[model samples]
Target: MQLVVARIGRAHGIKGEVTVEVRTDEPELRLGPGAVLATDPASTGPLTIATGRVHSGKLLLRFEGCLDRTAAEALRNTLLIADVDPEDLPEESDEYYDHQLMDLDVVLADGTEIGRITEISHLASQDLFIVERPDGTELMIPFVEQIVTEIDLEEQRAVINPPPGLIDDSQAEVASERDDA
Candidate 1:
């Protein structure tokens, strides 16, 4: 089983229990005992859940090996993950993980292939996609239903209807100006 859940933030307490910034919608259910958290391929170690409780509406977790303030502090920026069952995910057809969107080809409404998605950034109001074109130009597109019309994950392509002045030929000139500045 592959672990997909990301540890967004840390816990706040004195008992070696850290708050987990859950990536999944169901945080309460997934932070149960015996859940394994793999940090990386080289650091893929199990985090035995000593106890889990909700404090101030956040998931507070205590691992078996971590039993002190220093131990919990060590995990301040660490990520927690567990094996996810694909069937357990939400049935929303439009929803996709950021990892799944990476490397997807971005195309305009007129079938002009713009770029490939390199990253997804979060803004105060919406998510933005960083796309890298073949010409090495990077375009920042707002990821909204209004602009993104279709996402074919199997084909690894995203069809977008960019807003006016977003992808015009003059946009390159603006980019060059910014680079010069």
Candidate 2:
């Protein structure tokens, strides 16, 4: 499988270094120097990483054959893709990649069908699973331990333990009385 690991940002200085917005969790392994990555535009790459550094908390990478600002600027907004094997799983048992979680059937604890995970939206606070329901409507489910209880990769399913009102407003309770006497 091909995973987008980073997006090339603006050129960093006169050198061929370009700032990048990292998309992968394992940057050191994927973005390390001498790592050859495929590019999105196809014609721009496959580019080879000559060097990488962290400057001002941002990752900067210099590609081989790109020796100046102009050359680096040409790669701006280009996506860097990394080749990955389907069987190559994460070392941690509990951890999973976004690609691994995608397309899994979402179900309730008793195996009630909810939806299918279409996208994983990474937010500043928490990740959200964009689920497509059987009725063709989309539902945003919080990807938290309190809600998403289990992930059965072998079965290709995700079991969620949703609280009342989480699945539908009909299951939610509303106030029946007010104290504004």
Candidate 3:
């Protein structure tokens, strides 16, 4: 499987270094020196990492053969994809890849089916599972330990303990009105 590891940001300096918005939890392994990554735009790369560093709390990378700012900036907004094996599990038991979580059945602890996971939205604060309900309506459920109580990969299901207003439409509207007031 091919997974997106990062997205190239603006050029860092006059050098060939460019900033990257990391999408993966394991940047060190995927964005390390000598790592060859496939780019989204077929023409741009298969880029090889020459060097990587942390500058001002941002990850900066220099790709092999990208010798100047012009070369680096040209890669802006390009996605970095890494080849991954489907059978390869994360080192930590609690860790899961986005692919692994995709399409899993979402349900309440009482076994009431809610929906199927359609996508995962990765935000700075937390990841959200975008679920498609039976009627084709979509709702975002925060992928947190308190809410997503369990993930049973074998059974292909996620058990959640939703808080008030999270899944209840009427409760959500009431909460919204309360905020407006």
Candidate 1 segments whose C-alpha is farther than 4 A from its true place: 1-4, 8-11, 25-30, 41-44, 84-89, 122-124, 168-181
lDDT of 1 by residue, 6-100 (tens): 46355466778888766654565667777766664325356777888778787788888888777787776666667766445355877876667
What's the TM-score of every candidate structure? Answer: 0.74, 0.89, 0.90
Superior by lDDT: candidate 2 or candidate 3: 3
Task: Show the colliding residue pairs in model 1.
Answer: 11-18, 11-19
- The number of clashing residue pairs in each candidate reads 2, 0, 0
Give lDDT tens digits, candidate 3, residues 1-181.
9999999999988989999999998899999999999999968999999999999999999999999999999999999999999898898999899989999999999999999999999998999999999999998999999999999999999999997798877888888898899
What is candidate 2's lDDT per residue for 1-181, written digit by digit as tens? 9999999999999989999999887999899999999999989999999999999999999999999999999999999999988888888998899889999999999999999999987787988999999999999999999999999999999999987777787666532122222
Top candidate on lDDT is 3
Instruction: Output the TM-score of candidate 2.
Output: 0.89
TM-score of candidate 3 versus the correct structure, residues matched by position: 0.90
| TM-score leader | 3
Candidate 1 minimal-lDDT segment of 10 residues: 36-45
**Where is the poorest 10-residue window by lDDT in model 3?**
163-172
